[model samples]
Target chain A: MSNQMFHTSKSFDQDLTETTDLFLEMGALAGQQVAQAMHALIEGDMHLAHQVVEQDSAVNQLEVLIDERILLLVAKRQPAARDLRYVMAVSKGVVDIERIGDEAAKIAHMAQQVAADNSGTYSYHEVQHLSNQVRLMLHSALAAFEHLQVERAFDVMRSDGNVDFEYQSAMRALMTYVMEDPRQVSHVINLMWILRALERIGDHARNIAELVIYISSGTDVRHSDFETVQQAIDASKIG
Target chain B: MSNQMFHTSKSFDQDLTETTDLFLEMGALAGQQVAQAMHALIEGDMHLAHQVVEQDSAVNQLEVLIDERILLLVAKRQPAARDLRYVMAVSKGVVDIERIGDEAAKIAHMAQQVAADNSGTYSYHEVQHLSNQVRLMLHSALAAFEHLQVERAFDVMRSDGNVDFEYQSAMRALMTYVMEDPRQVSHVINLMWILRALERIGDHARNIAELVIYISSGTDVRHSDFETVQQAIDASKIG
Candidate 1:
């Protein structure tokens, strides 16, 4: 945000800083959960998966807190355009982070489901590959958000297509696996659910990236075409 | 909202009403799109399916409008507790409705894919059943949200379990069909995607129902046990 956009109220500035800190902390926690949830699944550690599930409540609480703070801040300060955009992006970004937490819990739940019965173990190389890609995407996206870097957000957005491609390929390969061996249907289905959750996390990261770009450039890059976003990225002013 | 909650300015009430009116219209339009998307798939009418995808932008625009009005109202009037909760619920409610529209578009996109290669005609009875169930859920959920009917929202929540059961059954059946004839893998996959989309729509409707209860009771019923929600529904102040 620009210096001119900052209000004179000391409390307002402090509250904004506190909220941004909370949001970043929440995002980092959620990213850790995503990684740990995948680890629990790959290791077949039900205890760790349950821990991930239990930790989701904390993420939920943070979302509620962040949203309440945002509404309060907007009502009290009535900041200028840049600050308003920042507030809006953070408010919207919290939801995606919360959703990512939910997705992590979903991955954990799927892990528990697969372990419920002594069934065949589904392969995880592709899932791990996709998870790593999204985890990195999320990490970079969060950094971009922190620094208000629109170009970094564009890079995150570009990486998402590869995640999509990986997801579809994994889904098709899983479908083929089940078709080849009828008995593997249940096992493969559980794995597919995990893949779907990971794919959704990637989408949420992309959403946060778009919001980051919006806050930085005052542009709605969400539903715009690739060429439009690319041109905006090319012509963007700040780092 | 209570009389005390209303601002002295007449435009406050007018803007609130306008926002609510826009939300209800968007919900109704999305419900219609979901119905039409299912119809397109069952009848192999790619035209209607494509129409659903193309028309999603309008629903999206309504969300943007509702959100903007909400922020403006909060910044201008700073509504009291009761009105604040109502505004927050409505703001969050629009996200679920917009997501429902995206799911409808997803169903339409899947329909277009299945139609691209007419290898087989997927069964429609279960698909229609789940589609009808979720459409009704969205309809009733939206009504409950409009009227703040906690009991009706509870009823909507109860129906979602049946949708989940049916989705699982349909997935199992689809898997068996693909196993029986590998040539039908692509066709079965498309049907599975449609089922998944419908299932997700049901989930979104359930989320909206929970929000309705929250707005009415000022209680966070989300993620609460069904028994707890049921008790709250029984003891709720309003219908």
Candidate 2:
């Protein structure tokens, strides 16, 4: 290859790295927000909850900036094949990260409501456990993306069933509370929304994991069962 | 332009048109699924609900096909400026349409559950009205995308406020039912999930409308207030 071609390719690689770095930065911030929001909710820290809400703008800004970089990279580099798929996955992954931030903010809002409405100590242990599980999933998914490790992505996918199960268990427990004291219905509903937000965050993490698989395997694993996705990943590895 | 350049440009335009048409087709199917699911729920037609559940795969297939076309279009044509934005919007819009199908399928599942548990008329009039409003919003959002009309997009944005209002009202009314008869708690919760799905469907439609605005004005109106988005649309028109 010519020197000039080599130089162009190196610069393109640098651009891709920089773009991925920005995406990881966004993911880290989103993960932090979810953690902080859950901490605030569990501890009834209104100030921390407000902070999470305010910090969401940073996540949104990162998303917009990352999207701009992606558009420029595509328009200039016009990356082909694997490079193209990688860029597309990065673009979609940024979206899911942004949504995670949104869900965190939503959780923060509900936390504030729960704090305001309930004077007594809120004793929803399941929400805390579920939030922890979801945060782990989010962290692992981001780690998978940063390292391009399909194993970590698969780990995240496998954990989602546990999150769903915990969510159902939490819902059932909350229902009993609501049924026992209808007056606590509003407060319980707020907790339910918090649980729902956490579950959705888990889903966004799964989506990121799927994107990781897509980038590595050139497979659209969306709407596919776990077995199918696993087979696709294994085949890609062997090939 | 030279003849060869003109020929290439014309073919690119045809590709863009075909991609957009496929996207619109998916959007229409999603809209129908939502409507049919609602109809099945209110009328308690298990067969129709199952049909909606089954048809969702078609929407997923369209989404995958559209994504393939978009990646090819971007890699081959290297669309820049307005054309690039249009393609990006179409890509994201297809994801939202597919999600709309998912939400509709979720509602169908809940409807089936509700049918199994209760023989009495499921008097969720608020859900019916909310479904109608959301269907209109979805239809208008698709129309806006097809025609590239910011005004229609704005209309969908404004209607979202109404959908939210209706959703809260539905929730409050359902709460009263649960409070009055704790035996109906399970049924009410199912209805609440249905309401939640419809509200989310409205949100996805709003996201599509935002994409429409983004395509037309090159402004990322996401996470912006109505007044701010309106100003951006107005400025784009003036510019």
What digit string (tens of lDDT, one per residue) describes model 1 on residues A1-239?
Answer: 22233567878888888888899999999999999999998888999999999999999888878877876777567665668778877877887899999999999998898888558655788999999999999999998888878788998999999999999999988877877776676677778878989999999999899988777666677777789887776656644
Span of ten consecutive residues with least summed lDDT in model 2 chain A: A1-10
- iRMSD (1 decimal) for each model: 3.5, 1.9
The parts of candidate 2 lying over 4 Å away from their true place are A1-8, A119-122, B1-8, B119-122
Model 2, residue A235: C-alpha shift (Å): 2.9
Model 1 scores a C-alpha lDDT of 0.84
For candidate 1, give the DockQ: 0.31
lDDT of 2 at B13: 75
Docking level for model 1: acceptable
lDDT of 2 at B53: 96
Native interface contacts kept by each candidate, as a fraction: 0.10, 0.41
Instruction: Identify the leading candidate in terms of DockQ.
Output: 2
Which residue pairs of candidate 1 clash? none
| TM-score (all chains, Cα) for each model | 0.87, 0.93
